[model samples]
Target: MSLRISDAVVWQETGEGISLYHTETGDFRTLNETGSKIWLAVAGGGGAQPVASALSREFAGTDPALIKRIVADVHAFIGTMVDQGLFEESPA
Candidate 1:
């Protein structure tokens, strides 16, 4: 599944990171580089596989063994966001 931004949610890029605001619920979230990349990847319709691929490429040779854990962590993190009402699953 991909992800859809909540209704009326606004996002902005700042030097520090990415900022998100949901006007209807008054919920806001701030994300660092990795988070921003994940958010953008999802917003662009990249599903879990593509998301994982991006993460893989990001840290390709740095720590080959850590890639799996990193990808899994991102998936889990995104899943939690869905539960938190920050995002919704979308059709592929």
Candidate 2:
């Protein structure tokens, strides 16, 4: 499956990262560089594996032991995004 941002939302680039506006809720959220990378990967239909790979690349210099944890975190983050009406999972 792939993820897509809500049609009711719009995003803009910011110095720190990216800002997303949820038009339906009139709420806005800011994501850091890493978060934006994850969001983009999913939004572009890259799926969970690509998101995990992207996260892995970002922390390539870090400990290898944390790889699995990072993947779990990415999945959790994606779920949270879906819960917040920021994204929807779709068939590839």
Candidate 3:
């Protein structure tokens, strides 16, 4: 599946991190540096696997187990964002 930011949400990049506002629900979220990177990847139309791969390359030389953990975390993060209505998922 591919992921995209929800139409009801708007975001801005700040000095410290990224800020997201859900226009429909008035919900607000702040993402740290790593989260912002993942958010940007998804916003650019990346699916979970591509995002995980990109992150793995960026952190190349890390332990294999840690890489697996990172991949799982990326998937979890995207899932949570979808559950919170901050992102929409569709068939790739």
In terms of TM-score, the best-performing candidate is 3
Tens digits of lDDT, candidate 3, 1-92? 99999999999999978999999999998999999999999989899899998897687557898788888888998899999999899998
Give a tens-digit lDDT track for model 2, residues 1-92.
77888898899778878799999999888998878988878767778768886787677546676777788788888889889998887877
**Candidate with more favorable, higher lDDT: 1 or 2:** 2
Better by TM-score, candidate 2 or 1: 2
lDDT of each: 0.80, 0.82, 0.90
**Model 2 alpha-carbon miss at residue 45, Å:** 2.4
Off by over 4 Å in 3: 60-62
For each candidate, C-alpha RMSD in Å?
Answer: 1.9, 1.8, 1.1
List candidate 1 segments past 4 Å from native.
62-64
Predictions ranked by TM-score, top down? 3, 2, 1
Candidate 2 error regions (>4 Å): 61-64
Predicted structure 2: lDDT? 0.82
Among these predictions, the greatest lDDT belongs to 3
Give TM per candidate: 0.82, 0.85, 0.93
Per-model tally of clashing residue pairs: 0, 0, 0
